[model samples]
Every structure is written in structure tokens, then in C-alpha cells.
Target: MELPKVGSIGEYIRQQRQQAKISLRQLAAQAGVSNPYLSQVERGLRKPSAEILNQIAKGLHISAQALYVQAGLIEDREPDSDVLAAIRADVTITERQRQVLIDIYESFRKENRAGNPEAQPTQPAEPPPDAAVHRENTATPDSKEG
Candidate 1:
């Protein structure tokens, strides 16, 4: 996919901010960025980092992934399901909390796929050393407890 121009992304952000009925100064304050920096970003004179984009997304009450796609940090793919969209759009939860929910949802999907008999088996990957050690430590009987 062709990457969107930085100016286009900036324009998109400007449009979103306007559509949300938020002033540039208010957005910058909410996003925890300086007014001049935000102005530069809106003018396409500055490219924002992922962290800044996340803050801006939160301020705009939108998904960070949407901004990431517009910034060309990620490829624009198929639209998310209504459930996933709702999860991402929820403003009451922190970003970390949203991510945790998404992780759990994806894990359940993977588990469901694994149970399907028609699914092709893939080669198992080696577990990380820390995970291996954790399993071993939990599996062993506590000799000291007795």
C-alpha cells in the first residue's frame, strides 16, 4: 500500500480535532504537548512520535491504531469488528487496560482455533527461558514448606 503523505496525516488530525469541536490549544493541553509543537504537527512541519500520537488519539477520543495507520506507521488493513471497535473506542479505560482486554480476546480466539480439527498443525515454537523456569519452579514441590 502506498504510504500517506505526512501532510495528509497532519490534515487528517486537524480535521479530527475540528470535528471533535476542540481548539488546537485545548487539544495540546489535553495531549500533554506544547502549543507550538502541536501547531508544527498540524502544519506538517513536525512528525510526531508514536507516544505523542497515542496521547493525541486519547485527546481526540479515537483509537491510536487509526492514527498509526494514517501516519503510515502501520498498514491499513480490514476494518475491525464491531466488538473490537467498541473496545478500542471506549474512553473510560486506560490504554494499557484496553491492550490487556485485546490480548485476552486474541488468546481466546487462538485457543478456539487450536480446538478446530480442520486447522493445520504448525510447528511449535520454543518457550522463552523465563517461561520454562517459571513452569519448572511452579511444578516442583516446596521442600522448605515441610
Candidate 2:
């Protein structure tokens, strides 16, 4: 699927909402915004704040980073690994989990680049020990435990 161009966050949001088979009223209610406000946003008449965007992302059951990227709030990076792309595209995992994985992956890339500026970017970063307690008690949000 072709992504909406950057700065066209409204179009992107609308597309995602439609793709999810949600109506405008349903999305507005799910997103916790007024229907008129959401309509304005979709029509490009109003720009949504980060908080609103976050709520919309949650309502869409998608990674907030995806919205942020389309909103131009996050700088879109291109990595050759395809791992980052897959991570973002994965709908099975919770948004928080996706973010943690992305953070770890980017950190690894940064470290690698720092150590060898000429080295090509590669390797999917593994979750840190702290990120994995493997215990029910330490579960993060959306985890079975919490």
C-alpha cells in the first residue's frame, strides 16, 4: 500500500481508519474526540495535537510511532534490514511492545554507527534484559499479566 506523503497526516489517518473498517463516527468516538473535530482533522481543516494523535493511534490499535511518523512528528528513517519495517507493520504485538523493540533496534544502529562510521547498518536489536523479565509479575501493559 502506498503511504500518504509526509505533511498529509490527515489523509494518512483517514486512510488508516478506513482500512480498519471504522466509520468516521466510530473513529471519533473511539478516539475520544468530537465528531466535528475529527471530521475537521480528516478534512485537513485542523491539525491534531500530539495527545490527540496518540488517542487516535490507540483507537486505531496501531503503533503511535506510525501516526507520529506520518504526522512528521518523528523523523522517518530508512533502514535496509527490513526488520524495522516488519516490526512496525506487525499488528499482533501491542503498541508499547512495538516501540520498545524499535527503541532497542535504533539504539543498536546508533551504537554500531558510532563504533564504525563506515559500517553498513544491519542486525535486528534484541530486547534488553531489563525489557524481559519473562515473569508474569513484571509484565508490561497489554501483557497477559497486566
Candidate 2 segments exceeding 4 Å error: 1-6, 77-146
Kindly report which residue pairs in candidate 2 clash with one another.
none
TM-score per candidate, chains pooled: 0.51, 0.52
lDDT of each: 0.77, 0.80
Model 1 lDDT tens row, 1-146:
64344555677678778867899999999999999999888888788999999999999887788789778788645355566667655655655576688778777767767897655457799887678443355544756575
Native-referenced Cα lDDT, model 1:
0.77
Task: Report how far off residue 16 is in candidate 1 (Å).
Answer: 0.3
Which pairs of residues collide in candidate 1?
A: none
lDDT of 2 by residue, 13-83 (tens): 78778778899999999999999998878877777888999999988887787888767788757846699
Question: Residue 25: error of model 2 in Å?
Answer: 0.4
